[model samples]
Target: MSAETASARLADIQSRIAQATKIAGRRADDVTLIAVSKTHDAAAIQPLIDAGQRVFGENRVQEAAAKWPALKTATHDIRLHLVGQLQSNKAADAVALFDAIHSVDRPSLVAALAKAMAESGKRPDCFIQVNIGNEPQKGGVAVAELPALLAEAQAAGLPIAGLMAVPPFEVDSAPYFALLAKLAREAGLDGLSIGMSDDFEVAVTIGATHVRVGTALFGARA
Candidate 1:
């Protein structure tokens, strides 16, 4: 995408976020817009960086490792987030690359991440992904199991930042977003990694600290 296009898209999303935060009686800077740049190459992503988008999310550790080292070197202060299901085996790589991890779901992955962080001395802020809709195919801890998992993560020395969730697709997501925010409050955490391109405004009004927006910022994937 052209630089102008990227700048315009980023501005539009920022404007929407500002509007939502205003309606919610919150500061716009309190909402962090994570430009989900998964699947886009450097050519596509650089424009966004040039447009002043410093934070981005990628799905895979390998893909991020492939691209971000050079990108981070070229630019400065770019934060990368892992917003996809993380396998236990890739825990070290994920810990090394991402500034924040938004998919800490299972005990195994939690253990793996703790070990990786301890050995590497790098603790990326972790958001426990909760399967709010109870969908069988998703990668979050079931709602019923969230408390236990949170305890385990805390005990394992994982930096429990907050909660993350993706509501069932094609549905009214406000309720789910509210539930996630409530869960975060009950857990005594602050960050809410809810919302995407479609419902980020709702997510913001409902108290999302981080919105992982991809399609709206980068345009639809090929």
Candidate 2:
């Protein structure tokens, strides 16, 4: 995308966020926009950053690793977030790269992060993935299973900042997103990763601290 095109798209997105926040009776600044730049290249991302986007989310660890170095050097200050299912084997590399992780769905991943964080001397903020839709095909702990998982993570010295979820693809998502926010409050968590290109306004309405927006900002991935 040309810089002008990318700038216009980003401006539209920010305007939507402002409108949504106003309707929701929340400050627009309350919502942290995470540009979901998973499939896009640094060429595409740099312009977005130059236009004043500081946070970006990536779905794969290796892909993020490959893109971050160049983007980091080019952009003055940027935060890389891992917003996808993170494997245990990638824990060390993840700790080295992301500023936060929004897919801590298993105890093993927690343990792996704890070990990796201690070993690498880094503590990347993290969120527990709650499978609000309870889809077996999705990657997250069931809602009913969260308390136990929270306990285990706390005991393991994992630094959990909040909860993350991808609502069912083909259903109304507001209820599910609200449910996750309620669960996060009950668990005393701080972050909510509950929005994407399709439903970010609803997410903001329902109090999502972080919204992962891709196509809405940079157009659909190629």
Candidate 3:
């Protein structure tokens, strides 16, 4: 998309978020927009950045490492977030690069992150991803196992910021968003990193503090 197009898209998304927040009786500042730039090259993403989208999400540590350093050097205000499943081995690299991690799911990852954070003296905010729908292929801690995972993560001194989830597609996402919000509240976490391109407005209405918008902001992946 052209820079103007991307700017318009960003404005539209912001407007929708404003409307959704109003409907929910919440201030627009309560929600953050994470532009998911995974699979999009720096060239493709620059327009969005030019459009003033500072917070971006990437799915892979390697891809982000390949792209963001130079981009960040050129644009100093950029904040990167890892919004995909992370391997324990990549924990240090991820901690070094990202400003937030929205996929802290299991005990092993929690331990790895803690060690990495201590070694690097950098503790990026962490969001526990929960498999709210019990999807077999999804990358989240099972809801049944959430409390245990949270305890382990907290014990490891991870900055437990909130929770993230990708609901089962082809299903009405409202309930899933609501469920995630409910789960976040029950866990005493005020932050909810739920929502995406298709359902983010609904998610904000239901109480998502962060929305991971990819396709809507960048257009479909090639």
Candidate 4:
């Protein structure tokens, strides 16, 4: 994508976010827009950076490792977030690479990340993901098991950021977003990392502090 194309896309998304926040009676600045840049190579990502998009989300630590070091070197302000399911074994790399992680779901992963943080001397803010719809294939702690998992994370000294979830696809996402917001509030978490391209405005209305938008910003995957 050209710089102009990226700028226009970013502007539109920002405007929509502002409008959504306004409708929700919330401040737009309170919401952070994380352009989900997963699968897109560096060539595809640079335009957005040139357009002043500083925060981005990526799926895999390995892919981000391949792309962001150079990007971050070029511009030191970029904030990278890991927005996909993370394996326990990849905890160390994730901790070292991401500024925030939106998929800290299991106790085993929590334990692994704690050890990684200790060993690497790098601590990344973490969001406990909840399978809000109880989707079997998704990677989130069951909502019912959330409090215990949160207690486990806290016990291991993890820097808990908030909660994240992906509502069932093709379904109305508002209820699930509302549920995630409620769960986050109940857990005393101020950050909510919910929403994607299709439902981010609704997500913002419901109380999403961070939105992981990919196709809406970067366009459909080729």
Candidate 5:
């Protein structure tokens, strides 16, 4: 996409966010817009940075690794968020790569990441992924099991920063988002990585600190 195209798209997204904030009686700053830049090329992200977007979300370790080298020279203050389930084998690379890891679920992954971060001299913030809707295919700890898992991770000295969830495939999902927000608040979590392109406004209305938007920003990915 041309810079002009990206500029226009960003303007539209900002307008949408402003409107959502107004309707919700919440400050726009309350919701952080994380542009999901997983499939897009490096050149495509420069325009977004030019438009004052500092945070971007990526889905895969290898894909993020491929793009980070180019992006590093392009912008100095950009923050990269890894918004995918991290395999234990990839924990070391994840430690070296992202500013925050949003999909930490199991105790094993937590232990591995803590060890990896310690060894790499990099301590990235992390979130416990909650399988809110309890879908078998989705990767997250069951909501009921969160407190225990978090306690275990904390015991292991894993630096957990917050909680993340992807709502069920075929549901309203607003209630689920609201539940996650409530749970996070009760747990005193500083981060809530919820929402996507389709329902980010609802996510914002219900109090999402970070909303991951992909197609709305980068357009449809093949």
Candidate 6:
């Protein structure tokens, strides 16, 4: 996409976020918009960066390592987030690269991340991913097991930022968003990594602190 198109798309999303936040009586700045830039190469992502998007999300650690080192060196203050399921073995790489990791779902990964942080001295903010829909195929701590995982993560000394979830597809997401918010409140966490391109406005209204927007910002993936 061209720089102008990228700016326009980002502006439109920002405007929608503003409207949603206004309707919800929340400040627009309270919601951080993470442009999901997974799969798109540097050439494609540059336009969005030029449009003043500083925060981006990638799905894989390897892909992010491949692209983001150069991108981050070239640009200042760019925050990269890992918005995909992360393996325990990749904990060190993820810790070294991402400013935040939004997929902490299991105790083993928490232990690995804790070890990585101890060795590397880099503590990335972590959001425990909850399998809100309880889909077997999904990668998250089951809702019932959330407390255990959260307790374990806290015990490991990880920087627990908040919770993250992806609700079931083709469903009204408000209830799910509301439930996630409730869980966050109960856990005493303030950050919420819910919402995506399709329903971010709804997520915002329900108190999402971070919305992972992909197609809406980068256009449909190839």
Q: Write the per-residue lDDT of candidate 5 for residues 1-222, one digit (tens) a residue.
A: 777888898888878887888898988887778899998888888888888788899999999999886787678888889998889999999989888899989988988988897798888888899999999999999988999988888887777878899998778989999899889988888778888988888887887778899999988997
Show where candidate 5 strays beyond 4 Å: none
- For candidate 4, give the lDDT of residue 14: 97
Clashes of 2: 0
Candidate 2 residues lying further than 4 Å off, grouped into runs, are none
Model 4 stretches astray by more than 4 angstroms: none
Model 3, residue 87: distance off in Å is: 0.3
lDDT by residue (129-181, candidate 4, tens digit) is 99999989999999889999999999999999999999999999999999988
lDDT of 1 by residue, 72-152 (tens): 999879999999999999999999999999999999999999999999999899999999999999999999899999999
- C-alpha lDDT (0 to 100) for residue 127 of candidate 6: 99
TM-score of each: 0.99, 0.97, 0.98, 0.99, 0.94, 0.99
Residue-pair clash count for candidate 4 = 0
Off by over 4 Å in 3: none
Output the better candidate (1/2) by lDDT: 1
Instruction: At residue 48, give the lDDT of candidate 2.
Output: 89
lDDT to native, each model? 0.96, 0.91, 0.94, 0.94, 0.87, 0.96
Q: Lowest-lDDT window of 10 residues in candidate 2?
A: 67-76
RMSD of each: 0.5, 1.0, 0.7, 0.6, 1.4, 0.5
lDDT of each residue in 99-127, candidate 3, tens digit only: 99999999899999999999999989999
Q: How many pairs collide in each candidate, listed in order? A: 0, 0, 0, 0, 0, 0
With a 3 Å backbone cut-off (N, CA, C), the pairs that clash in candidate 1 are none
What is the TM-score of candidate 3? 0.98
Error of 3 at 106 (Å): 0.7
Q: Report the lDDT of model 1 for residue 57.
A: 99
